[model samples]
Target: MSAKFLQILLIAMAATFSGCRNNSGDAHEGESHEGHNHEAEAKSEAKADPHAGHNHGEAPKFQYTAYSNSHELFAEADAFIAGKKAAILSHFSILPGFKAVEEGKITAILTVNGQESRAELSAPTRKGIYLFEITPSTAGKGSLRFVISEKGGNTESGTGEKGELRKRGNYEVIVSEVTVFADDHAPYHALQPEPSAVNTTVFTKEQSWKIDFATALPAQEPFGEIIKTSALVTSSQEGEAIVSAKSAGIVIFSAGVVTEGMSVSAGQTIASISGGMADNNPAIRFEEARNNFEKASADFERAKLLSADNIISQKEFTDTKNRYDNAKSVYDNLRGNFSRSGQSVKSPLGGFIRQLFVSNGAYVEAGTPLMVVSQSRKLTLTASLPQRYLPVLATVREASIKANSQSPALSLGELKGRVLSYGKAANSDNFLIPFTMQIENNGSFIPGSFVEVYLKGLSGTNVITVPVKALMEEQGLFYVWVQITPELFEKREVKVGRNDGRSAEILSGLQATERVVTAGAVQIKLAQATGTLDAHSGHVH
Candidate 1:
């Protein structure tokens, strides 16, 4: 026989003996005499074979390991040896970039004691995995090399080394173990909080110092229904006044630096008009009038002396006196105002420079406005409400005003203010009723600037209210942070009712006495999105 055929025959005979031993005890237990006879025949066959009674060495044992890029995909391999046959079971998952190998795509090379054997892949009970069997000539430590061919001509290869096998009296026992990689257990993906789940974010004492976090308790307070409307900040006619040019000339600013919003005192010379034609310039006209007045004065003195001496007629004396009086009146009018420069404009009131009508070098006609001075200490807030609200307008017990800047809104109860007046009838142009409230400006409120007015009515009892700063919005949904513990917070969605610019009324989702984050809410929102919150034991408030 050929050497290759002899090797195949030896392997087949070994497998036959292994199968007989497993079946012998079961069949012989039913009949003692028959079982004895069968055992005698098995012993005769084993004695006849030279390799039957000899130890061929231990059966091959395998250690299977698994690995994957993420927990979504898991890979495992089970390898063992039963009698003379070495079997390998490879399990794969269809992940994002990897696919399962087909029946003919797997090839394994098993090497034992310097001898190598190749086997074709076979299907297993489960899908997406494969199995194959190999027959080794001798028993020893073995290594399995596997190559899986992908449909796109790519290949994946792995090696199982230091594999051993052991044998028992009747059957070969195969042992397998598995291992997995570490990086698949990432914290962010593994420990994400569900949207509807109550998740507490832990802020350590050390981390809390880095953030400006503040909390306030929701309490039962007198919350009133607020009517919000746009309003205009204006100065009363008596509280504000404008400085105008008395004569037409070029405007020259008196101060080195003059701009709108600059504070000015009453009777202060803000600017002067100079450089005009002789007829228009008050300085030149005053000089000509003074010369005429000197001549008139001399004539009047002569007339008076002649009248006393009876050498001049009464009519002549009266005419001379009248001309002298007119000249003197004209000179006196120009004396105090005339200078080399021209007419000077003084501020009518002590206040800020509200407006500058003309530039420094610009020319102005007589009576042209130079600048507006306003006493900002007292101002008016005028709001136009829909005609339908006129019924409730009478019930407005308090009001507040908020500018479009960072300054906090001024509450009427804290500051000096009251509703001055309301229109008796709706305006014909906009069909909206106008209401006015007087306020003390306190240096921050600017005239003519638009502001928001909150008209609060009678307060309602047993209402939960929180500071407006405690609320945050995401995708049109309002939420607030409830302190679950001293250093932990949980986000909660809330339904909001009327807001009075300072405090907002909560209709749902919060209880009185529960502490909510009034500051640093944005920081907590960002931490929640990235899953950077540390884990801690927290109790709900």
Candidate 2:
């Protein structure tokens, strides 16, 4: 090849090698870009926090020493000693309400037992307590869990022998009533929205027991009043006597027969039947004999007259007269019921016919069932009451009944029942002790319909009551949620009372005025169950 041609080939080969290297470099750069993007994403995710809300970030805590006994309460209107508090309360501190230090001196004034006792006032402590115990003053172990600074911040607190009021940091508290318990292990572990306020649940029975949940409201906060639902009742009835058919057989037709419940006059035939008609009414023979006897009787009468007039012998007259007597007897018996097969049986009383067993042109035999006669103008609702309610029934002075046929059974109803009879045999349906309620039905009540009853007997003074839905239960423990913040719900325990079967009674842990979770209680719990929320895990004073 020529020298010039050789040089041109070399140049072309060099250019091709350079092109291959550039392509390889471009491919590697694409993969490197993906790796860089992935690394950036990972960094962003790691910097974020899941538990951001609970990051109390070295929040000040106070220690609690004194407390109220945490005993359980049972039975209605039970009271607890004022000083007893729950052991769950861990610390007590006078967490500085406020020290108006005009020029830098702890110029705070703490009045103990109505006297100016010295205050070891200091900064807010780092402790958590169930409650606070007042100094051993004539206040009689009085407990104050919070204090207020002239400013506006609130301080959480507990019971103590002598409170050490502080001077610095956030502060404000208005201690109110303290909870007392009967048994330490009461189901008082109810959930609440705020840790400060304790609320209780009323699982069953009206006002059976009380849970002592002191509120943080001003010492003299007025309690919300209570009210009772109407009375309890059963089915509506017309008359006292409830009757049923005793025999069973094929029904027979009557002139004006109808099914059960068709009203008819007293004389109107409720039911009827021509029994044994297929066998040829035996009474037919008696009727024919009766006719023959009638003819013989006529002949005998004429013969008797002849005998008297000497036209016939005495023996003949006597024989004819005897034959007339026999025939007459037979005819008289047959005349009363010559054709028993077609004889009509009538009712004896005057009332509406309630039930019938026969139809026209129908045949029945002996002992066949006819129809039932009901004396009841109305009906009564008989209920099988549970034995657990025995005591409640007796103590009740009055009761009312409601029809259970409501769209969704509830406290509202047409309460129009009264007490009729009580202490009957067991009910046929539930087999519970029977309680008869004579419901004067003006036709509003049907005999076979079911109903529900609400009985309000003894009542206490009116107090604020919360809806049962506002309450929450977990692991046998009951509680409520306070709408502390728009999106946050604090879990707290409460004690409750009488159940209207609609709303639950609040005994303690909640204030009547405090707004609670009307719905979505479970949702709040699920959020808390993850320990994402301190829930009841942390301590409360």
Candidate 3:
């Protein structure tokens, strides 16, 4: 790659790795290993040789090259094996032109053990060259021949010596790069937090609004509309009355049918009997029962009077009264149902009858829905709240609402509401708590109309604050990396409070003085995972 292109690629890499390199876990010092010298030694060795051939006989069987500095080429055997994985450190561009050469092109050659194997030097680019490996390939004095040509440069001969037994010199390729703390302006450390203030962030019950945030978080964003849950609502009466059959025969509503949805009203045709109801004697039986009840009633009243006058025993009076009540109750029930089947039917309350289960012609055994009537209609609004907000509202209390139909745009111009609410217990996998509110429809809201509910009397002032993006929650624990210096950052665990689904309240572990990572925490996080990012060096994160 061209130097400029490589530099460009590095910038992009720094940005990508910035997130991962540091955010994973480790703290970095940006320290690198020391460099070694090879250039001077090479030139000095060349000077000593003075163009005169080294006595093939005198050049040590094991000799070295430092690039001429410290002549670092080490050797042990006759030949060494190395793969095409070669690092070429040249003074000029040799990569592009060399790569242009034919594949497996021979750029270098080697002579070893009376058998010579050509080591090809290849340039993958004009600025670089890779030798199809030779040295270190075999275990001994690795050997090779140099036949490389450079762009705008002359083809040259590589200097190697013929050795006897101590299998000598191996050529060393040298590369150099400065290893120091990169400048804050070195195209990487821009926007790092300054280091003059305390290396901490602070906030309290006041000045929260002024706390420096890493970014903006808004609440106007749209959320999914809440779906409604269906329910049945009813009111109980002041009295409990029993409606039953007159005899042992089947008990059915005067109307033959029964079911939840079927509609019925007073005086409506319901059900009738086949045998007893078909004859006039069912009425006869009811009259007989009524006559017996009248006699019992009169006898019981007389017994009560005699007991009061001490003319009868208390036990006798009590027995007479019990018998009279039972007889009268039986008589009344028969009288009320005699004209119909032994079945006893009653009128249902009234309203816009919603459902009708039994049809006009379907037969029902007994206690079936002949029909039904509703007394009134009502409206309800249902919605979900984040679990954190569940505790702020009360059960069965008024709440303010804005409905499109009734108050177009809801102009109450006055604060009003009580909280009657129910919702899920906490923020589990499903973070929403479901709730419903009963609203008396004033010919305004419909059952399915959309509405917005506003919780009233909810108020708060200043509190600890932080940017939403800076907070990272893992395993329910929250943390943020605070930029502790122009070149360092410290990962800090924090306590979070009141997340209005936007900025969060920092209850602890963070403050206003330290700046936290806002936009690239993920990059820093991934880098930390792969051990590439230095958490200690303040940069992108």
Q: Give me the candidate number with maximum lDDT.
A: 1
lDDT of each: 0.67, 0.43, 0.43
Quality of model 3 by C-alpha lDDT: 0.43
Which candidate model has the greater TM-score, 2 or 3?
2
Worst 10 residues of 2 by lDDT: 70-79
Order the candidates by lDDT, highest first — what do you get? 1, 2, 3
Show the colliding residue pairs in model 1: 59-165, 59-166, 60-165, 61-164, 61-165
Q: What lDDT does candidate 1 reach at residue 79?
A: 30
TM-score of every candidate: 0.49, 0.31, 0.29
- Model 1 lDDT tens row, 1-541: 6999999999999999999998986775766574357678878988897456655343323324222221011222223332345445554432221233333355656666677677755443345445566665544566555554334332433211111221111111122222111232221232324333356665532343346755656868776667989899998777899788788888888895689889989888888788577667877877778998999999999999999999999999999999999999988877655557777677888988998889878988888988889888888889999887887788786887787658677788566877888887999999989998888877777788898888987755769888888999989989899876535678889999888888888999999868788767887777778774543222110
Weakest 10 consecutive residues of candidate 1 by summed lDDT: 166-175
Q: Candidate 1 or 3, higher TM-score? A: 1
Cα RMSD of all models vs. native, in order, equals: 25.5, 25.7, 31.7
Better of 1 and 3 by lDDT: 1
lDDT of 3 by residue, 1-541 (tens): 5999999999998898888877653543553324634577677877986543433332111111112211111111121223222232212111111111222222544444435444555443322223244433222233333443334333332322211121123323331211111221221222233344333332210111122322212222212212222322221121111222223333334444455445556444344432344343455566678788999999998998899899988899989999999999988877676653333445434433344454433444434443334432444456666665555544324334555424532211222222245765744766777565554444544433466554332343445666567788899999886754312345679997654322456778866655566655554455455543332222110
lDDT of 2: 0.43
Instruction: Give residue 301's lDDT in candidate 2 (0 to 100).
Output: 80
C-alpha RMSD between model 2 and the true structure: 25.7
